[model samples]
Target: MDLDQLKTFDRIARDLSFTRAAAALNVTQATVSMRMRALEDLLGTTLFHRGRQVTLTDQGMTFLPYARRILGTAQEGREALRRVERGRVTLGSLRTMVAPLITEPLLRFQEVYPGIDVVVTEGRHTQIIAMLHEREVELGIVCWPNIDPLCLDLEPLVVMRERAPLVVSAEVAERLGPRPGIEDVLAIVPQVISLFWWQVEPDQASALCRRARSSVELPVEPALRLVERGEGVGYFLDSSVREGIAAGKLKEISPPEFGELYRDTALVVRSKAVLERPMLRDFALELAKDFRCMGRVIEDRLVEDVERAA
Candidate 1:
C-alpha cells in the first residue's frame, strides 16, 4: 500500500491503541481506523482484532516484521538520495559520549560542508563495534575494549578534571562519617561507573569496592544526575562531569585509595576503505584533533578557575 498507510500501521502496532497512535501521528482516530481497514482490504488479511481492547491478530503478528522492514527501507532510501545530493558521513557512538564531543563537531562540520550529511546512531560498546565491522556505519567511537579484527586506528582521549569538587548531600556525607573506607562508602552510596574501569588495575577496582556496593551500569547523564541528587556517587570521564561539578550539583568523593582509570578511545574503520575517500581521512584527522582540544580546554579552564577560587 501507500507509505502513509504503512506509517499508520506501524504507529498503531507500536502503541497498540488507535487513539494513541492517531494522536502521535497527528491524525484523527477515525482516520487511523479507516487507514488500517484499507490496508487490510488491500492485503486480504485481518491485521487487528476489534474489541473493547485492541490487539494484534496472528496475521498482524506475521506482517509486523515485513511492514517494519518496508518502512525502514523507504527511510533509508530517502536518506541515501539526500546523501548523493550532498556528501554524507555515518557515525555511531555510545550515547553517553556523543553530546560533549561528537555532536557539536558533527554540527560544525555540517555547517562547513553543508552538502555533507551526517547520520549518527547510538548503540552500546559491543553493538557499535559490530556495526563498524559490518561497515553499516563509516565510523564509530567507543570505549577501548573488544576491538574487532578489522584494521582500525585508535586515539587516546581523557576527560578533564572538574574545577569544583563534587560533594554528596549533607545527609549522604553524614551517613558515612569521617574518612569512611571505600568499601563502606560503596556499600551505601549510589554510584555510576564506566564498564571499562573494571579493566583497570585490581587495586583501583578494589578501591571502589567500598564506594560501590555493586556496579551500576547506566548512560552517563542519568548517573551524573543521580549522583548530584545524592542518590549515589558516579564515576565518569573527568570531562563529562565538568558542567555538573561547576554548578556545585556534584562533589568529588575521593576514595583514600584511588588510581588512574584509562579508557582507550579510538576511530574504527577498515584501513583499505580509507584509500578511497580523501574527505574521510580528513574527517578522521579533524576528529582526533577536536577530541584533544576539548579535553585540554576543559582541563585548563578547570585548573584556572579552581586556583582562582582557592
Candidate 2:
C-alpha cells in the first residue's frame, strides 16, 4: 500500500473527520477521500461508516492499530534515514507541550542551525516518552508531577517549572459555584487525565484535580476536547488552557489549600551518547531558556531536576 494512503488513513481514523484531516495534512477534502478510497480498495473492505460523524467499521477497528503501527514504522524509517544523511535532528514532543514550550525556540533553532534540519514528532505524553525509550527519537519533553518517571530514569536534559492549573469547563465551574472551592469542585467535577497518568500516584495537585466522583484516562488532545465540551475537569498546563479560559469556555479553579500547582517540564534524551554532539546540547539549552522565559509566574518553589544520571 502507498505510504501516503496509510498516512491519510491514520489521520482520518484519529480525527474521524475527512475535512479536518485534509486541512491538517494540507490537502483537499477530495484528495483525502480519494486516498481513503484507494486504501479501502487495496484492503477490499470499507474502513469507515462515512456518516455525518464518521464511525470506523469493524474492518477499520480491526485494522486501526496495525495501520498506526505501519505509519509509526514509516516515520521511524524516515527519521532514521534523515539522521544518517547528516545535519538532521529528530525531536519527540508531547502534543500539548509544543505550542506552549517549543514553538518559538524551534523557529530560532532552525534559523541558527539552518544546515541542521530539525524535525519534531508530536504524540501523546506517554507515546512521546515511549519513543524516547525506544530510541525512535533523540529527545522528548514531558510535563511532570502528573506524567513523571519518579527519579531521573528518563535521562534529563533540562527541567523547568510549568504552572499547571486545576481547570474545568465553564459550565462545570458554574455548577460548582461563582468561585468554587475544593469541596465544591470535588462534589461536581470529574477528572480527565491522560491514560498514561492513570498509574501516576496522586500527587499534591492530584488531590484537587482527581478528587472528583468520576474520571477519564484519555490522551491530552481528547481530554482537552472533553473538558471544552464540559464533560469533565482536568489539571492542564496553564498555557494549555489559556485560550479556552480567555474565551470563557474553561476556567481555572483554585483549590482551598492552594491556588496553583507546578509541573516540572523535563527535556530528556535517550542516552548521554546522544548528547555527545555539542549541537544537541546547544539545542537543549535554547529550548530550556525559551521555556523559562515563557513561564508566566515565578513561584516560591524552584524545581532542580537532576541532570546527570547518578
Candidate 3:
C-alpha cells in the first residue's frame, strides 16, 4: 500500500479509534475508512477488528514494524537530499601541479567546508582528460599549452602562467658561470633532468633529445630532488624552484638563447558536468580564486627578481 494508507493504518492503530485517527490526520472519518478498506483489499486481510471497541488484528501488528521502517527510510532520504553542506568533490591533477598549486587551496577548502570531502587523483594530462571524459572526476589541473584537442568539452576555469627556468645546483652554476648559454650549461651538466609536463616545439624537442641523450627523464617531484642534490640540472616551473633558489640550494640559469619559457597550469572542469552539478561550480569558483591569488604572488616574485638583477 501507499504512504497515505500506511499512515492512516498507523494513526488508527495508535489511537485505537478511527474517529480520533481522522482528527489527528486532519481527515474525515469516511476518508480514513476508505484508506483502511483499500489497504485491506491490497493485502487481502482485515487490519482492524470492527466491534464496540477497535483493536488491531494479528496481521496488522505483524506489518506495523515493516511499514514504520519504510516511512523512516523515506524520511532519511529526504533529509539527506536537503543537507547542502555534506558532499564529496572528486578532483584529478597532474602530479607536478599538486604540491605547488593544489595543496594550499585544498587545505583552505577543507578548513572552510569540513563536511565536504575532496578526493584528489593524480595522473598525467592524458589520464586526467580520460577521467573527465569518463565522468570519474569533476575537476582537473593540467598543463594547458599542448592539451588534447579532442576533449573540447573541458572548460578551463583558471590558467596560472609562470616562468619555467633552468635550475642548477650551486656547484654546477659556478662551473657554468654567470649568463651561461644553453650549450655552455649542457657542456657542464650534460645529463639534464627533464620534466614530463614541459610543452616545447617539435624541433626543440628533437634537438634536446638528440643532444641530451644521456639525460634522465622524470616527473617533477623526483626531478626536483635530483636537481637539489646536485645530481643534474633541471628545467622547472618558477613556483616549484622558488624555495630552493631562495635557500641558495638551486640557481636559475636564464640563457637568452633558450628564450623565456613559461608553463600554463589550468584548472579545468567538464562544462556539462558543471551544468549538471552545481556544487562543482561552487568548488571551481573558490579554487579559481585561490589560483588567481597565487598567480599574483608569482608575478610579484618575478618583479622582485627583475629589480634585484637590475
lDDT string for model 3 (208-293, tens) is 54576377878777787788777777667777888989999899887766665677777776763353454555566566666676
Candidate 1 local lDDT, 72-101, one digit each (tens): 999989978877677767777766567777
| Residue-level error in angstroms, candidate 1, position 55 | 22
2 versus 3: better lDDT goes to: 3
Q: Rank by TM-score, descending?
A: 3, 1, 2
Best by TM-score: 3
Clashes found in each candidate (C-alpha, N, C closer than 3 A): 14, 0, 0
What range of 10 consecutive residues in model 3 has the weakest lDDT sum?
297-306
Candidate 1: which stretches are off by over 4 Å? 1-75, 78-82, 145-180, 187-203, 206-215, 294-310
Better of 1 and 2 by TM-score: 1
Model 2: per-residue Cα lDDT over 1-310, one tens digit each:
8888988888988899999999999999999999999989999999999878998999999998998899889898998787767777778887667877777877778777877878789876677777776776787776553344533466665566766777778888777876666676666655545434323534655554456666667767788888878777767777788888999988887766655565566677666666556567567767767767656433212123223411
| Structure candidate 2, residue pairs in collision | none
Comparing 2 with 3 on TM-score, the higher-scoring candidate is: 3
Q: Which stretches of candidate 2 lie over 4 Å from their true place?
A: 1-79, 124-130, 143-155, 171-175, 186-199, 203-213, 257-260, 270-278, 294-310
Clashing pairs in 3: none
**lDDT for residue 171 in candidate 1, whole number 0-100:** 59
Off by over 4 Å in 3: 1-86, 199-206, 272-278, 296-310
lDDT of 3: 0.74
Measured against the true structure, the TM-scores of the candidates, in listed sequence, are 0.60, 0.57, 0.63
